[model samples]
Target: MAKNMYSLMLMDEVVSQIDRIAAQSSTNRSNLINEILADYVSFVTPQKHIQNIFESISAIIDDVAALTVQDMAASSVICIKSALSYKYRPTIRYSVELFSDNKSLGELRVTFRTQSAELLMEITHFLSLWMQLEQHYISKFDSKDSISYAIEQGRFKRTLMYPKNSSLHNSDEVSKAIADYIQMFDEILKGYLNGEYNTDADVEYRYLNYLKSGLTVI
Candidate 1:
């Protein structure tokens, strides 16, 4: 969306209320007004599109026992929290933020905080392996250049790309793909750390099976 500056005259009371609502929603006055006007005009703005995707994801994950969706005031972001099946049950946070531009879909960030050096090292290793598997498998259908990844001390981030199938024009399919990916990642990571997955080949087998399950990949 191209934004331009324009002057419009409005009542002080109306502007005040808009400001209040914008503050509550964690957005600026201009953006709130733009969204309101866009709604009135039956136009789907980028923010609205992101909101629809997030809502669909929330609904799809609502029945999953392992994940809890947290309410966020911002429309562009969704935060989901899950616990690892390890000592002290450290919590892992998955934050998904969609972009407003067409360059890319969004970003998925997995973050874990722990005081145990061994646990952190294990998680870091798992994340590295996860990236390698994704690159090896996902590259068969999509360009490896389309995706980007980063691993920090306790956080891993991956850029979400648009699905190869152009027929998926609705938000529901996109949301389901993202939700399923997150669930698979969480389950696999926990399994690897809990010794359920005896070797890297075991993890690769599970991931390859998921890719063969005919689900949309992002």
Candidate 2:
């Protein structure tokens, strides 16, 4: 959305109320006013769209016992946390950040805070293998150039792409796709880390079956 500078005259009492609400919402006065005006005009601004998507994601994952949504004040980002079934029961965090621009949908970041060298090495290997699998499969649907992947010591990040079929500006479908993808990724990662998937072939087979299950990939 394009923004511009504008001058408006409002009563001091109204401004005070807007300020109070903005503070409560973790936003500034200008943004609160903008959202109010946008709502009044029924305009779906990028912020509003992002909020809708987050709400949809929350709804979709509400029944999942393994995933927990973290409280966030920002509208463009949602954070979910899940625990790994390892010896120390390390926590893994997944953060989804939606973009307002057209460059892409947004980014998914999976991060863990662990001091064990062995765990870090395992995570790195798993992330590398996961990236290769996604590159091999997702490229068939989207241009390989459109997707981005990165892996560090305890983090894996991927750029999300808009669904190829329907623009589906509606947030429900898009949010559901994202939520499902994260759940699948989390399950596979936990399994791999827990020694359930002992071989690369075993992991690949599981992933291929998931791809064949007709879930929308983004």
Candidate 3:
């Protein structure tokens, strides 16, 4: 979206109301007015689009998991909380920040936290192994062309680029992708922790099964 400077005259009462709402929403007067006009014109604002994406994600994972949204400082940032299937039920936080110019794609940061040092160690090792497995997995699906991942400590971050031409541009598809990725991560981590999957082949098999199941299972 592009911006242009425009001068407008508004009634004092109307301006006051806008200011009140803007204050409550933690946004400035100009941005709030822009958002209001965008909504009135049926122009999908980036904030609304990202909100829809997060809502869709919550709906999809509700069947087999829990989802919670955290208070955020800005509309551009969305934070979601969920639990993994690991012992003690480690929590996972997903923080998505939308690009200012595009609403359909953003950077997704996944953070896993647990008090157990043993579990933390296992998760750290699993993250490294996951990178290798995902290299092949991504190449298999050809999705590597648009997405990339990096890890540090208990965090795994992904840069999502959903071009307008791709299926991921669909909000439903984007939600499914997020849900599936987190579910798969939890499952693979559990498998490793339980000693059910140790080798690359075992992880590969698990990943295949996960995809074949249409990402419906835990």
Instruction: Itemize residue pairs with steric clashes in candidate 1.
Output: none
Using lDDT as the yardstick, the better of models 2 and 3 is 2
Assess candidate 3 and give its TM-score to the true structure: 0.80
* Whole-model lDDT per candidate: 0.87, 0.87, 0.72
For residues 1-218, could you state the per-residue lDDT of candidate 1 as single tens digits? 78999999999999999999988899999999999999999999888988999999999889899999998756888999999877788899999999876667889999997778999999988888998998888865553346889999899999988766454447888799899999999888888998999799999998888888886788
lDDT of 2 by residue, 133-209 (tens): 98888876662336889888788899988756558467888898899999999988888887889888878988988
The model with the greater lDDT, 1 or 3, is 1
Better of 1 and 2 by TM-score: 2
Shift of residue 19 alpha carbon in model 1, Å: 0.9
Instruction: Indicate the residue-level lDDT of 149 in model 2.
Output: 91
Question: How many clashes show up in model 2?
Answer: 0
Best model per TM-score: 2
RMSD of each: 1.5, 1.5, 3.6
Report the lDDT of model 1 for residue 69: 98
Off by more than 4 A, model 1: 165-169
Candidate 3 global lDDT? 0.72
Superposition error at 94 for model 2 (Å): 0.3
Per-residue lDDT tens digits of candidate 3, residues 1-218?
66788999999999999999999999889888998998999987766776677777767766754566677767767677877576778887878776745433678788888888887887777877777766665544543254578888788887765543355555677667767776677667767777899876797788878767765221
